[model samples]
Target chain A: MGKTIAEKILQSHLLDDGAVVEPGNIVRAWVDVALLNDVNGPIAFRHFANMGGGPVARPDKVVLVCDHFAPAPNAPGARLIGDMRRFAQEKGIEHFFDVGKGGIEHTLAPEQGLIVAGDLVAGGDSHTGTAGAFGAFGTGMSWAGMAAIMMLDETWFKVPESMRFELRGKKAPFVTGKDVILRVLGEIGVDGALYRSMEFGGPGVAELNIDERMAICNMMVEAGAKTGMVEPDAETEAYAKAHAKRAYTLVRADADAQYASRHDIDLAAMRPMVAKPYSPENVVAVDAAKGVHVDQVYMGNCANGTLTDLRQIASVLAGRKVARGTRAIIVPATQQVYVQAMKEGLIEQFIAAGAAVTTPTCGACFGGHNGALDDGEVAVATVNRNFKGRAGHAGAQVYLANSYVAAAAAVAGEIVDPAVL
Target chain B: MIFEGNIHVVGDHCDTDVMIPGRYLSLVEPCEIAKHIFEEVDPGFVKRVQPGDILVAGKNFGSGSGREHAPFGLKGLGLSCIVAASFSRTFYRMAIDLGLPILTCEAAARAAKVGQRARIDTASGEIRIDRQVFRTQPMPPFIQEIIEQGGLTAWVKAEVARRRASA
Candidate 1:
């Protein structure tokens, strides 16, 4: 009869006094942080304007990130960013991260400590679940829902049942949170956790770093999950203390918390997993997909664009040259991460290895711009979601892998385990 | 609300990208975005769909991305309803906000055929397709109220007016 972490967080933020928090019960809740991006911001603002245009309830809590089409990919994209800039200035919204100031919202939000444990965060982007890595209850909402939040500082939710994932054992060499999540997706298929919170815990949770945790939670949406969370621990505390801008409470699931279903994942048993074209759930071990030729190898996105991921790629491409006929593009997730990578020499090393290191934008990952694939091109990327046309032309194929695997593909021009190199 | 129409069928995991490719996301007009819906998977979808047509699909419909354009485009195409085995949580909320009725009935989704005449009663959760009667959980009273008010925007407008009056 105990409550899950998600349940407890939602309970504390309930807007209706004395409202019960349980799965399938709709409850109004206040959010501590709300994110809007270029793609959703324009629409949300239009709705806000149509609702008789008033000052937002919490300008400080509202975050507008121009990431999806940062630097203005086209005329329309520029217009969208222009709208965001003008609105931010007029409304006095505090946390507007423009083109060069930020990268992806999910990465920048956490890096800037906009969110902390036990807070309820909502964003118009599906990857808002990425904040759950910090033990916060983060979920995606509609633009209209966000507009309503902007007006009232609150939204509604049908409390979702929690699916407990007990990760046990330390990960093997070259294995990462990306592989761990890919393996989980392979086990459950896409809709296995639909509308359910994926709560991670157990001994293996300690073995993964905060960046790894972010990578895992970022893709929970691909599995149709409502949100993804990890139990707060010492590792979480260290990262939060260094970056968190606000006070936070490390919320934990009760000892006897009820779970809709339970899955036990052995990290040691995990390998360099890859999701084939058109589906994140269609996964295969690296060995099974070895020697598959790739025309491009991209290393970036909220899922795998962390500093740790950059280091992993640098380790693989340290002195090697990218294979002939293969293009390697590496993107840092945020401005801070880009500067840190530059200070650490990852950028120079990437460029020296025949790869192109670019600024922190989600352009390539979402096929918005930067490095869209040519027709029939094949790519091995460290990004999540390999859906058709995800990275480029519909005829093109994308293979989702960890940074190590992606970097190895850049060197070998094929899908191969990094350990083999 | 009762909606009667012919159904356009799609399979499971029909993501937002396939529904409305990410490239067209910057196009704010719903009708403009609707011109490209399912262009990749079904190139003829835009040309074939009628104003009152319904969209029938398997589980995990609208799986990827949180773009409201997917529902906006569908609504622009004048879809009466979307009946599927299930809908991703984000898409479900967007549909509700846009006043687009969506029902979760595995039997109804599985039994539906392309171009088949189907009828749905949102209040009753009854789906009728070719003499088959499938029952689904009806929309909750609160959500029904939102739909009746023509979506969240109108509801918010009325609420804002009421609050000002009270103040």
Candidate 2:
């Protein structure tokens, strides 16, 4: 039996006494990157202290980011940020990203070249799987698990079985990675890939860029997956060459790799998809949801806040003003992305079109701040999750869509396909 | 370890947001978080839930977010265990790491009713609900060890000391 890409990465990082890298076997493996954010950083720092705080095994590999509650939304949030700063300084952690320095941890880590192909990355945030976009094995863990990694530079995992998603054909115009993933979620339902690795490959993978790949991998968690990945290709190599700070080996699945199951997705047939309120799996075609009034339209998050997304959104909002009754919030995921959007004039177009463009922060996406919804409000956003109370008051509803569709909604004040706009 | 409690039933996809809304994530104290458990989805849940009550739910329980606060809050409220048809990987790991025992048994989860007394034997993977009996795969030795050691925090503490002493 040949090995899958996930198995190969995990096996390469296994400790001397680690178990075999097979499905259902628990193995302790070294981590290349251990990520933390303000929401979970303080707790993890406390655990690190409890475990006899000393110099971290790999300070450079450990990253602390403050985007969840950047700039401090309240006193408690401020305290969390303060604790992260103190710990970062005390430990001499080299990759501590404070507010105004970085954006969301997921988006920031990759842009800074902290992750590379074949690396095993763990973080305290669910969307940590976004690193899979770089052809690395990325998964989320508990704070205690993160603390253990911080101290010992290793963590345990029960190897997940692999599920292959073969992408074929080119995607339709205006259809982004968000639509592709929503379509997958609709097919698999929540838990369809429970505790399994979702591996993307085939010719269609070439059609989507890094941003689209990131968007696809980021939502693997929504399908209850352990991680999501794309096989390293020319585009991946180009990305790594441009940004990677360290050397990387492109790990690919063997020709006869074993997969628990496989699904074929034809990107050409893809269309604008929407996930109704309270569940990412509650999906429908845009036509089914057309004319559904929306009070707000938000574009940006770890899932869809890349430069690609900004360009897509800007293209839709180029000469259009936000509908009279609707408000739009556009957030660039990272400082670099924000600056790039500004240089490209995407930010200007957004603001000139009545959309509020904000700095790099995860505030509005996680309901931390910036633009939480009011009761009874309805929004169409590019965020990954639409669970109740995800973006604000419990009474508010959110629909998940690609950036193009979301921007179209901002201009129409209703759910409409970007193609028609 | 055997735990007996009345189960509080919830439907599928009981996400972390419903368990503890993102707004209250800033509250690190478990007790403070316990007060808001299921506050958004079921307003009276906190008031009605008693100590040692088990949570029975359908598929994909704790389906969203990697926040440990969800399981931490439940443990703080004295939840003895959680039995679900299935659990999201993140929540499942967080629960075990927090020393909160959970079991996945489709039959048991489906058969369970609100206010019914259920008993779970972690060692045997046996679940008794009312007059019905169900069996699930027992947790692996590593996970059992973590639970016995009272979560990863305590386990890591001892491991750190042991490694230092040996070194």
The lDDT per prediction is 0.91, 0.90
Best candidate per lDDT, number? 1
Q: After superposing candidate 1 on the true structure, give the runs of residues whose Cα lies further than 4 Å from its correct spot.
A: none
User: What tens-digit string does per-residue lDDT give for candidate 2 at A1-421?
Assistant: 8999999999999996446888988888899999999999898887788777888888888899998888788999999999999989998998999999999888888889998887899999999999988989999998889989988888899899999999999888888778888999999998899999999999999999999999999999999999979888999999999989888888989989999999999988888899998889999988899999999998889868899999999889988999999999999999999998889988888989999988777787888898999999999999999988989998899999999899999999999988887
- Across the candidates, what are chain A's individual TM-scores? 0.99, 0.98
- Best-matching candidate per TM-score: 1
lDDT of 1 by residue, B15-129 (tens): 9988887788789998898888888889888888898889999999999988899999999988889999999999999999988988999999998999799999999999999
Tens digits of lDDT, candidate 1, A170-274: 889999989888998999989999999999999999989989999899999888999979899999888889989999889999999999999999998888999
Backbone clashes (count) for model 1: 0
Error of 2 at A121 (Å): 0.2
**Model 2: docking quality category:** medium
Candidates' RMSD to native: 0.9, 1.1
How far does residue A325 in candidate 2 sit from its true spot (Å)? 0.6
Q: What is the lDDT of residue A34 in candidate 1?
A: 85
